[model samples]
Every structure is written in C-alpha cells, then in structure tokens.
Target chain A: MLIKRPDDIKPSDITDEKIYHQRRAFLQAGSRAALAVAAGAVVPGLMFPGEAAAQVAALQFKKNARFSTDEEINSLKDITRYNNFYEFGTDKKDPAKYAHTLKTDPWNVRVEGEVEKPADYQLEDLIRESQLEERIYRMRCVEAWSMVIPWVGIPLSALIKRFKPTSKARYVEFTTLYDPAQMPGQKRGVLNWPYVEGLRMDEAMHPLTLLAVGLYGKVLPNQNGAPMRLVVPWKYGFKNIKSIVKIRFTETMPNTTWNLSGPQEYGFYANVNPEVDHPRWSQSRERRIGEFFKRKTKMFNGYEEQVASLYSGMDLRHSY
Target chain B: MMMYRMKPALIKPLVFIACLFPLVFGIWAGFTDQLGANPIEEITHRTGDWALRLLLITLAVTPLRRMLGWGWLLRVRRMLGLFAFFYACLHLLTYFVLDQFFDWDEILKDIIKRPYITIGFSAFVLLVPLAVTSTNAMMRRLGKRWGQLHQLVYVVAVFGILHYLWLVKADYLLPLIHAAILLALLLVRAWYQRQALSTRRTAPQTS
Candidate 1:
C-alpha cells in the first residue's frame, strides 16, 4: 500500500522531456524520409536531417507553460487508434472509422450558467489568447486500461477566469456534440446522447485541469475528440469529456454520462483509486496499452500529491 | 450402421483431431495478429466461447443418439466431454496467465465478489470431478457413482450460460442465442424423460 512519491519515480520510467518536445521533429523527419524514398529524391542541401527537423518542430509557448511527468507517453498511433470516444461507436476501432465525418473547422463552444461573461467563442478565437503547454499525464480508464499522453493545451482555470464565474458556481459541466448524423453511435442509445461530464469548482480551477486543443504536436484528431477536450489527469478518462460544445458552471452536482448509465459502476468523482473496485471488475491493476502484463494501478493515477487534498474528508470508496 | 461399421481406433483419432481445430485456429490467429488490437481479450473470449460450445456439443450427443438410433454416438461422448474440459482449461489458463498474471488474491476476490466470475469458476470446478473420473480404470472403480457424479455437466452448462450472460456489458444477442440452444437441448432431454416415465407407468396396467 506504499505510495511512491513523484520524486521517487525513476528517470527511466518517464519519457524524457526532450523526446516529448522533439516528437514533432521525429514525426516530420520520419514522414519526410518516407516521402523522399517514394519520390526517389534525396536532400540536396540539408546535411543533418535530425537538426533540421528539430528546428522545424520547435514550438513556442508561454514562459510559465510546462507540465512534465515521469510516465512514458503512449505512441501517437496507439493513442489515436485505441480510443473510447463512444459517440462514434462502442468498439475500439469504430471511432477511427466513423469520426472522419465530423466537421471541426467551424467549431464553437458556448459558455453559459453562473458566469458574468457568458458567450459563445469560436474555437480559434477562444484559444488565441491562452498559452499552450505540452503536459505529459497518465490517463487511466475505468475499463482497467491505462495510457500516458502528451497533451497540448491551456489550463481550464485560465478559460474559466475569463468567463468570470459567480460565487454560486460550485461546479462546472461540459457537454459533447450530439448530432446523430455526425456521431453515428448516437442512433443507438449506448449512452444518453451528447456525453456529459463535470468537476467541482476547486477541481475545475486546479492547475492540472487542461482544456486540450492538440496532442503529440498536432491538432487533436477527430477520433481523439477533435478541436477541443478536457484532460483531467487524476480522474478516469471518461471524466475528460471530448468534442466539448457547451461549458456550464452550476451550483448543483451535474449528471455525467457514465454515472447516469451505471451509477454503481461509475461515480461523479471518478478518481483513479485502485482500492475502490468497480462492481464488474477489479481496478487494482491496469494493462498499459502496449504491455503484456498489468502493472499496479496507483491511487489518483500517480497524481495523489497534486489532487488528494481536493477530497480531504470524503470517503473515496463511497463517493466513487 | 455406418458408424458401427467404422473402427473406434480410426474414428476416435479423427474426432480428437477435429476437436483440436479451435485451439489450432486460435494459436494461428494469435501468431498472424488476426486477434486484433486487444489480443488478450480476443483469446480469452474465443477460448471461453469454444469451451461452452464444446460442452453444449457434448450435451447434444445423447439426444442425437436417441433421435437417430445411433448407439455408436455414445462411443465419442467421453471424447467430446474431455474436449470441453480441454477448452475450459485453456479458457481458465488465459484468465490466469494472460489476464490476471497469477494474481491469486485479486482472482480470489473476483471469484468471491463478482457473480460472473463466481459462476464461471464454479462451472470449471464442477467439471474437474467429471474429468478425473473420465478414465476407463476410474470409471470401473467408481461403477454406479460415476453416472451420478457426471450429472454435474447439466449444472455446469447452466453456470456456463449464466457466466456468459453476466460478462457481456450489452448486446445480449449472442448470449441469448447460446441460452436458446441450451434450452432446446435441456427441453429435448426433459420430453424424452417424460415419455420414458409414462411408458413405465402404463406398462404394468397394459400387461
């Protein structure tokens, strides 16, 4: 039951921060090399392809924008290919096949509820002001699977502050896009259409909470909740609602999709607690996407230091 | 008569080889990466599925013999039952080695806490006694007790169906289909039993 401190995590356990920053460079060079081979063309001028690629991949962020973790980031292919965005379908492969129909260019997120400056903002205009940072986080799903992802986004606190929430805003609710034509899974009621998720006001404002716009140095793929999504590292992946179209701050506890579907299995506070077993399956261990054997699931998904104080007095087993 | 004409040595080996088809195909699929993105899940599901299928097929042998008047069918009943046990072992091994990684404490908790695992574990446990007594020497040693003990297969089938029913999140179509097949097999046995009972009762009156 011993909890390892983030500092105690070995350097080798985490993907090097340099590798994460240079992911774009690696990808660009890889694709370029493939293209060059296909075209029977070689670099005429460039002597060091790696150096040139690094320069191309260097992205500028705010001075204070960086959240590094000691967990290895999952491959981009695995992240995009193996997703649980049930809006497209229930099967793992369904999203990649069906999410192509989604139109993300003309996207707008409507900000509403207990806020002074409640208004709709275009996806581009909204994110133009906030600084983007690359955060490596451990994403644990309720289905006993875990992944480490490098998310590129601004903190939710920055965006929430812009809206200027009233004192009555005790909680924040996020709503996903609900078009059946676009999201074919909506036709079948796998869950009540337009998946919803929420967080407490403190949790929402927590620096760890991210309003992700991109991942792995690219705009979020349609399968990975295109345009925008929430990334709450300490909680189950389902809490990170995708394709967010509406953001509402409320006083009451919001009805989340999974919690509504199976209250016993999923709770409002879906914190990644290994001790609190799901009614159907054991949560004590999780299979890291590419690994053969399961590793012990750390409480709060190894972010207990950052988020444990948020639920100081509440019993996680019951609340979960 | 055609089955009677065939030699036990020839047909038994053929049936044994045929029974191994599922395992062979499963291994081939695993090697070829045809088991898809989640290979472990695929193996677990396929092995469990084949185990249940073989158990049902074994249950069908007696009814087939009664309907078709093929006494020779009884010769392969033990083989079919053994194959069911074989697949069940593979199914259990997949869960233990691949899924659970020999985490006995977690597995024990699952067996005690989860209804699906409890039923599935019970089914596998019940099959063990029947499998142990499956040998010719043990069958002779046990005598009349052998038939009574092997009646556990009927209960095993029920647990197996319940196990499958509880495991699925939604889309009950596959489980319902399996349930329907099991029901048909059980109903046929009941009808035949009823016919035999009535005949026994009326035979003294007629005589």
Candidate 2:
C-alpha cells in the first residue's frame, strides 16, 4: 500500500531511479520512522554528496517548464530542509517533526500589493495553470553551511508576470503562512512572526529565482516548505522564505528577521559571496558536508560566473 | 579495606593499577581505531570523559568513606587525582597532536585566544604540582605544603567543568549533571568535616 506506481511511469523517463530505490530501501528497512524522527532532531545538514544530483532529478521538475535546468532544480532539492524558520519550541528539525500537523491540502496564495490583477489563487488552480521546472542551485545557509538542491517549481517572474506588477512596484516582499493555532512556533516570540523576505526588482525578475513547490523529484516534504516556498540562490539561506502564503510588491526595503536582529551583520543583500565574510569567521572557506575533510568550498559556491556580475562595483566588506 | 590491612603499601598498588585502567582502555580504543569516524573527536571526548570521571572519583573518596563506613577509600584519593591529571594531559595531547598537528603558532594562539582551550589548559597547568607531589616521599618532604599543593585539585575540577560547558553547543544537560555531582560531593565533605570537628570538641575527658 505504501508503494504506488505512477500513472505516468515510463522507462525513458529520467526520474532518479537511485532516489526511488533509496527511499524504497529506507522504507523497507523500517528506517522511515527513525529517519523522520532524527531528521526533526538534528539541524538539517547538507545532502549526502552525489545523492543531491540524483534526488533533484526525482522532483519531476523537467515536466514543469518553470524550472530553468535540472542543475538548478538539483541545487534546490539537494540543499534540503523544509524548515519554516521559526526556531522556537521546535528546533531546526522541528518542521519535519511537527509539520505533519499542518493542513497543506486546502492552501491558497494571495497576490496583492501593486499588482494589476490582484487575486486570491487556490493552490490547485496555480498548479494547473503553471508548468513546473526543476532548477538546481547552490544554497548557502547563514550559519556557514551549504547544500546543492534541485527544486521543482515555476519561476516567480513567470507567476508574477501573470498578475502583472504595477509600475510603482520596485521590490517584492513575501510572507510565510501565519496562524498561531496552526503554526505552534508563532505562539511564542521565537522570531517576529509573519516572517518577511524581499528581493530587488532585477533580482525578482531573474530567471533563476523560483517559487518552489516540490523537491527530490516529489511533492515538497512537510518539513520543507510544503505548499510553496522561495528559492533565491546567491543569497543567505534565510532569504529563501518557505511556506509562503502572501506576496506583496513594495517600494521600500522590507524588514527581515536576521536583518532586524543585527542590521550591521546582515545587510539588505545577503548574497553568497565568499569575498564577503561574517565577523565571526571567513566565508572564503567551507567544508563540504559528506566529504567532511576532502573537499574545499569555492567562490560564489562555484556559480560565480552566473551571479558575480550582480555585485560589480560594490564593496563586499560594507555589504557583508 | 585499608583499615583491616593497617598498611599504606597494600592499597597503593591496587590504586595505581586502577588509575592505569583508563589509559590502557583509551590506548586500546585509539590504536584499534574504535574511536569511530572523526577519531580525533572520539579521542578528545574519551580522554576528557576519563579525566572528569577520575576527578569525581578523587572527590568521592572522603564522602564515600564517611557515608559507607569505608575509610580505606581515602587511601586511593591521591592515585585517582594523579590519574585525572594523567588523562587531562592525554586530552591536551590529542588536541595538540592530531588536531593541531603540533602547529605551535596555532596552538599557542588557541591557548591564548580561545576561552574554552584556555580554561582547559589552565586546569592542566594547575594539576602539574599535584601530580608531581603525589608520591609518599614527596608527601613526607613537603608535609604541610603537600596538603596546600593538593588542594589545587579543587580549582582544576571547576576549570575542567567550565571547559566542557563552554565547548558544548546547547542542551548542557551532561555538563550540568557533572557539575551537580561535584557539588553534592563537595557539600558532603564539608558537612562531614564540620561534624568531625564538632564531635572532637564535645567529647568527654579520658580521666
């Protein structure tokens, strides 16, 4: 009963067989319960090395055109962690642990704030309208850890284009689902609830920026942003808000949690640039998760060519 | 045990051998690579664990004798204290050798700069005089000074706990438990000593 053959199953399909087998093996060994429990207990870490690439393929992103490439999708899924970012009664692992309590089936997205076509879109309606594309990108966490993931979702620009941003809109702000009764983390002041993240106009329109729905070639894990989330590579991990329910086009800079915590420490642009180091440690060096001792991190996490141009003349130290 | 024998020589060997057990087990574990992946972490943890255990054992001797009617336990206190110093030395060695690769510049910088390492190193430095004066000959030569020197173990114990507490990420339950046990043992010794002094003062004349 746990295993169901997909209606669209075909041998020619490039869905990661390794991931399917890995999940099956994990289930067959009766490790699903333990893995699920442990996943909620530990700080969600980097994916197990080469498995990131395989896991990204399984997200079924290619069928969805919103994703730019499998590599982009791979980077998003591989970075993993469906954590909703409220480090309260639940820790980093709490989302996967407590998120099962959430009801994502009847989800909806409210498109407002300087949009020509302001509307409340049901989750099912959006899925039907937009084609999913898997994009793989390097995801860098603020805590000096990093992961590559393949995420299946439509580009935010593509979705936003449908709504048509007004000429006055120069920035995009996203809000996470906020209900104290539903999201237990909101009951306490773990972080200023209704977490907000923003992007500049150019960054928002970038082809790589995604509003993700699923990862690992499957429906988004509850611990991960189940209904919908943002994937903004080159930015610090927190910039990619998860379980988004609202999007607002704004003219001013938004107040983000980390930015509010220490404005000097976290700037408006939390891009993943090795040249910009946190005061505590150098960002130039990073330890690859599974490799532990072998692999060393590279500049812009090996995507320098794609994103470095965005910060052409600015001083990294000031922005860092 | 020491009471029935009425000989200092008898308990010394047993205590010495018991003190050596942690070293032997730790060495075997390290050599066989039983320390697990990140052998460095395992070695550091194991040595630090043994050091704390021995410190607790050393502190336990007096209270254990008073509460359990096993006065002989006090005879092994010096040996256990010395063994704690031994393990603390090994713990530092593992960090310096495998971890820092004896990079003097980095090692010196860590000792001077890192608060956790400083506490750990200071505790080790305080332990040196106690270990050096642990022998019966040194005890006889120093006499009153020996007792004063050995009391440094108390400072070492506090520093050891702080070293562990500062290094932990969160959920300091284990270090807190160790601190509680040390507190309980220290309180027991103080209470028992007060009772002994009072009893001696209140006793009737032999005449």
Candidate 3:
C-alpha cells in the first residue's frame, strides 16, 4: 500500500495489518537485512545465496476462527502437486512440475486504477506489516472436482481498505504474470495469455476474501501461485487468479480469462452453484480429491450463509 | 510378414495378452500408488482411451488387408473388435460403478441430459449386438446380412470420437488427433470403393 499521506495514518486505518513478527530474532535479523531490501539496489538471494528463499520469512500466523472452517484440509502433497495453474501447463499435475521456472523472490504487485494510493509493492514489503490468518475453505473447480485447503493470508478487505479505493472502484481486476519464458504454458494458445479475474468492490472487501501468500502453514510453493494469489472461496477455482501482477479498479465489470475464452460456458460471476450446470458436465455433484463416492455439491460451495446476501435479489442463474 | 505366417494358435494368444495390457497396467498402477490423486478418473480415462484406440485399430484392419493384401489380418479382426467392446464395457462400468457409484438416477440423468455421456453410452450400446453375434454359427446364419450389420462399427467409432471431443474443457489436441485418424480411414475406404466401382464398370458385363 502507498503511504503517500503519512499524516492521516491511524491505527484503525492500517488496512490488512498482520504482525508477521513471529520470531523476534527473525524480525531483529529481518530488520538488519531489511536494510538491503530497503536499499532496493541488490537481489536478496544474491546477497545471501543458497538459503531456502521460501523460508526467508516463514510467516508466524494463527488461525482466524471467525472466518475459518472446521473442514478437514486436503493432504499437503495433493494440494501442492495437483494444481490448475494453466500458466505452468493445462494438466492438473503440470503446475507442480513446471512452476519452478518462475522467479518469485523479486516480485512486485503494481496497483493501478481508481485508488487514492496506487503503488507497486514488493512481495515482502506488501505483507511485512500484516499478520497472517489460516482459513480452511472448500475450493470447487468448474471441472466438477473440489479440494478443502487451509490458506494463510490477510483478509483482502483489509488490503483493499489500505489501498483506499475511490468510489469509481466498482470492480477490481487482477492480471497474472505474463512472461512466457517462466510460464511455458503461455507459449501455447491453451488460454489467452496473462490470465485475468475480477471481483466486485463489495466482494473484494468481504471478510471472507483472502489474498493467500502461503499454504498448509508454509510459504506457498511456486506451483500454487507463490508470493500471492487471490482466494475467493465461494467461487470456482479459476476465479482465484494466481501470480497476480496488477490490480486495476474499474467502474465496469472486468473481462475474466475463462469468460473471454468461452463466454457461454464461463461467466463474470463464477459463483459455485449446483443448479446451473457447466456446459460440459453436471455441476450438482463433485468428486472430492481422494474420496471414492461423489458428494452432492452445495450452493456457493456451502458458504451461502455468509455470502448469499451479496447477491440476494440477483438471479444467480442469469449471472452465472 | 512373419505374423501373418503364424497359426491362430500362436498369434491369437499374443493378441489377447496384448489387448489385456492396459487393464493389467491400470491394476498394477492402482496397487503401486502411481494412479495419482484421483485413481477413479485415471481408470475411467485409461479404459476410455484404450476402447477408442482399439476401435480405430479394428477399423484399420479392412483397409490394411485391401491395400497391402494381408488376408491374414482378417483372422484377428474379430478378436480386435471384441477387445474394443471389452474396454468399452470397462469404461462404462468405471463411470457407472466408480464415478457415479451406481446411482441410477444420476446415471440416467447423465445418459439423457449430458451430451458427452449420451454419445459415449450410446456408442457402447451399439457395440453390444456386434459383440454378441461374433460366433461362426451366428455369422453363417446371418450370411450376407452379417457384413451389413457389422458396418455399424463405423458409426460407433464416429460417435466415440465425438464423445471425446465434447468432454474436454480445452486442449482438444488428443481428441482432434483421433478425429483426424477416423477421417483418414473413412477417406481411404471411400477411395477404395470408388476404385472398385471404376474397375467393375470397365470390365465386361456378366449379363
């Protein structure tokens, strides 16, 4: 977040504040090392070669009971290995195998459009002040499979509030990193390059919305969209765009990648509704990752109690 | 060339074991934990793939025999065709028992409402009669009509390709390759038919 007007800062105004100061020694060490980060001249990895870059800042996070579900999480191996990151490849296992090519340590998220404090944030600087929350939620894929994942991140609303979106910010658009060299799938025309996703202003600020930086209490593996990825639990998995590079706030609804690829099949609001079947198959039932028998899929992936109000009068069938 | 010279005693057993390889590999994969996270999906996909592949292989027999004069290819055609049906049955059983867990309502809904499943299941149904009438007695009883009845293999193969093409979300490469092979086989048959017609016209009339 851009702190252009430092004078107006209040403790309450500290949007998406999470204290990642888990290990005091790490923070004390981090503060000393932050001089290199703050200097912005050198790559941290070059300065300290061959260390576990992902472990550089193991977030000290606690589970947020208010938003977390008690559902059993999928095995970490399954969660990490079986991903739908089309950037790496179209196959379910492709991301886990090919995503290592992505250079994530020196990442930057360029915030743009309709925000008072639009600025590019280094992956570390963006979440350094934020305390992490582990929220377990069910992720339903449009392909009729689902996984329960425990994601660790700050509430996206807190992050949005920090950005201080203007009234014109009716919708928030996200774009995935576009370099074909790192993301080999971009070389093929499987999807329009640089995957895009969007959420309404209200949905962006919804407490359930999380910008996930880690998975299963570890720094997110590159396959699972390392550094940062959006986690809107109530929607289909694709709506949670990975490896986001830009956030554009728009008055009009943004065009999402899947929707653009097949408008009749995918929609702007990809809420998980069993009533509306996918063009290819039935949406009513889903095969859980390891389960033998299929389970009846719930509306909004069983998160309707919290989020149904967001689309109360609107016909989900039409919007879907 | 040596394969054609071999007796049915030697060749049929080899063909039978070769046909059983996919199922054996799947069962082995299941026990060894190589079936990945979703074994059910893996099983369903493998059976379906082999079923389609065997159907194409079965379709190729007549063309290869006619073009290259490998008359012995016809000896194994029935076994190849039966193997296609075997795998198709397994593919349908995988969907009916494993994927849907024998929920008749859901299975019926899929067959009637879902286009991909409808095509795939319909293709399986078309193969049942072909499999049942493979006996020498039934072939002799039907006589000339038997060849006409067996021609439904072409229709079933086409539907099988369509079923595969419709089921995928994107990345239609595999399905399209199957479709291209089917198209080429059809073209070859049509060309052979035209050549036979022209030769018949040029010859003296039997009347």
The C-alpha lDDT values of all candidates are 0.80, 0.66, 0.82
lDDT of 3 by residue, A120-218 (tens): 988666674246667788999998999999888877776777788887788999999999999999999988878999998888877778998877765
- Deviation in angstroms for A132 in model 1? 3.4
Which parts of model 1 have CA positions greater than 4 angstroms off? Answer: A1-65, A101-105, A117-121, A128-130, B1-18, B33-38, B60-77, B135-145, B168-173, B199-207
| Candidate 2: chain B TM-score against the reference chain B | 0.86
RMSD, model 3, all Cα superposed?
4.9
Over the stretch B74-165, how does candidate 3's per-residue lDDT look in tens digits?
A: 88999999999999999999998999888999899989988999999889999999999999999999999999999999999999999999
Candidate 2 lDDT for residue A18: 31
Model 1 gets an lDDT of 0.80
Question: Highest lDDT, which number?
Answer: 3
- The residue-by-residue lDDT of candidate 2 on A3-26, one tens digit each, is 112222232332433322222112
Whichever of 2 and 3 has more DockQ, that candidate is 3
- Higher-ranked by lDDT: 1 or 3: 3
Runs in model 2 deviating more than 4 A are A1-59, A63-94, A117-119, A127-130, A180-190, B1-207
Winning model by DockQ: 3
iRMS per model in Å = 2.0, 6.7, 1.1
- TM-score of chain B, candidate 3? 0.95
**True-vs-predicted CA distance for residue A273, candidate 1, Å:** 1.4
The DockQ of each candidate is 0.33, 0.06, 0.67
- Binned by DockQ into CAPRI classes (incorrect, acceptable, medium, high), candidate 3 is medium
Q: Model 1, range A47-88, lDDT digits (tens) per residue?
A: 122223312232323322235676677888778877888888
